[model samples]
Target: MRLTWIHPEDLIGHELRQARQDGRAVEAIARRWHDAGGHDAPPMAGASPEPAPERLRRLAEDLLDELATIPSPLADREPTGLDAVISACPDWPGAPLAAPGPDLAGRLRGAWAGRAAGCVLGKPVEKIPREGIRAIAEATGNWPIRGWFTARGLPDDVAERWPWNRRSAPTSLAENIDGTPEDDDLNFPMLALALLERYGTGFGTDDVAQMWLDELPAGRIFTAERVALRNLLVGLASPETAVYRNPFREWIGALIRADVYGWVNPGDPARAAVLAHRDAALSHTANGVYGAMFAAALAAMSLTANGPEEVLAGALRVVPPESRLAVAVREAADLARAEGDFERVLDALHARHADLHWVHSVNNAAAVAAALVHGAGDFSASVTSVVSAGWDTDSDGATVGSVAGGLLGADGIPDQWTAPLHNRVASTLTGFNGATFDTLAARTHALVQETSG
Candidate 1:
């Protein structure tokens, strides 16, 4: 009975760590866990299956409850509510007045295809570190990630040392890819699309919760979304589902679901952020919510942006200027612009955010921004650069692909990247399995017209 992500004992250890990062004083709580013979939580990426004794489990549950109520010192500056978030950003860009252009369909098509291509590219190495990724890729002659990873000539030692992510390798490799395989990175955007179609852009948080129960498979969701699913099943409501016993509230789950919001609200970052806020509020808080807003804003701007620098600057306007996530993006973008080499920029970012979990919103968002800034509007360069940085590779690649794709349009992305997808994608959602990206783009474009009108 040791479910890896949700076991109360395991969750308490992670919650303690999360609280401390939020500037909450948790020294006494850490001492209590140590006194109780509990080890610190395993790294967020590792699996631990040994069941805790009953006493420890109860203590863990009680501690999680206590942790939820403790206020972080940064709370006021990092408010989660949409209005408060907008208020915190003094230079906030009001909603863009520009409408989607005649080429909207092509841009949307590029975004969908680009997202799938980039996601597929990073899948095989999702959890491997930067050095390991480099080692494996260099060994296979794919270093700098010019294309999908391969085992064709990888050394046995390199293969053993940096094994491909088990679930991703069989389907995501260059030789094995048929159509895009089902991945949470792509699934969430599909879910967002379904949500808009069902409830329109004005859908509430409850609507988001209900949609998951109806369409999103419980097993497919993870981390914060998993906790929120559990909360919803037990009858806990919207905003509460995001916080109760949910230490993963600030992780990157919300960020990945942001693209459809931006897609439908093309050229309007402020409105895109508001829609993203509604969706993100169901499972995330603080910087987690901000991460979604940032991505949605970026994606929205990409439809009309002249280049990556414009996309980054316009997106930054939606995030709270003083929030840690904002500071990280600004620093990452600044360093990328100044240094001009992605590897050096990544090293600086990795060292600066070493204390963060691999899936945390702040670090992953920083990496995405750095990639876009460094890539400077080249579709191949942007997606490849982000995946190479190694934190949440698939997710970062998908977001970077999305923004860059929207900017470049379908005709601009290289055929090498788009051809493998066969214009198709797979999903666990009811109507999306084997759906073509162009069809999805048409459907999404229809919404853009509807919403804009």
Candidate 2:
């Protein structure tokens, strides 16, 4: 068999562009290409290409399969208590608040504070309908979906109050929905705390990613082949087919949350990206990895500068130029600079790219783009812009917020954002109840010390 290598760029040119420009159906193009020779098939002869939806879906499914194989073995024993969890760390000095080396302490503090703010940011809108989000945005003059929590109308100490569950009260629109607000892995801050608690200071991105997969409950999850198929479909095609397509909204949060891994490494965004890749592979691929890389690179950069443009530039350096993610980010940057209204920019991007996937790569990439451009390096502004623009709001907001928080440090985050959450949050993961930001940070710090030492 004569082997022919199909570069990602070739796929983009032959498949992606065809779907975008030639008006060919993704499935027909894909089927023709598959029949002609699989990826090596000659470009369809005079085939009018369909839109990129099916191609996007195929890509998503392949990416998911790639993600499912990254192995993560659990610790020899499950943690019995907080002390048991803390005891896992031998390197942590367990230093008092007045201890030396405030930089480490500061990183720890910022991680916790960021976690709290993340919870507050995500709590009110966990299950909010699109109409509700729009209404809130219209009523408050802030983009409701993204900027709802940032409005000055909320209480001063909202986040700080223990048990943020009360804050989950149905947003006028959700009032009729039954049942209390539930927290799951989809909630970024809570997930962060869970990882911190389980791994302690040993929490590297690889470990975190594995933990996420392990949470799928061994027997109930999809097979590796099924995961691969699902990834390939969703990544390369449209995510509109919710039944079988990848749940990108859920995955992007996981992908972006790996930034703290990069942040701990310092000036090693590549290492961060690598770590993120390992984790992301468990559930995503291609642009999924790009999403993780973007978040990790931004977090790594945040350790050095507070400029959104600079940080985005740094992130772009890490992702391949041939990727849709790169293209989307570039487009977003252009829109952010040229357009005055952030919503308009998103609307424009959607008009062009929405068919690709509403919650997958292109749209999420747009969110990252909006955050960096409109956020201008302000933690609140970046998060607000990313979230408010809608479409995978939490994932984009979390990534933007985390990177901004990492850059600004704990003290740099506004009091209003941090003060409301009171440095506390919880997750659905079984082992990490009653976690505080300070404790999670201390555990993460200790893990790094142990790993690096």
Candidate lDDT (C-alpha), each: 0.90, 0.51
Give the number of the best model, judged by TM-score: 1
Candidate 1 per-residue lDDT, tens place, 89-179, comes to: 8888765836778888999998998899889998999989999999988998887789989889999999998899999999999899999
Candidate 2 displacement at residue 120 in angstroms: 3.5
Kindly give the stretch of ten consecutive residues in candidate 2 with the minimal lDDT sum: 91-100
Q: 231-271 in candidate 2: lDDT tens per residue?
A: 44345322222112232322343454466656555545555
Best by lDDT: 1
What TM-score, to 2 decimals, does candidate 1 have? 0.98
Residue 105 displacement in candidate 1 (angstroms):
0.9
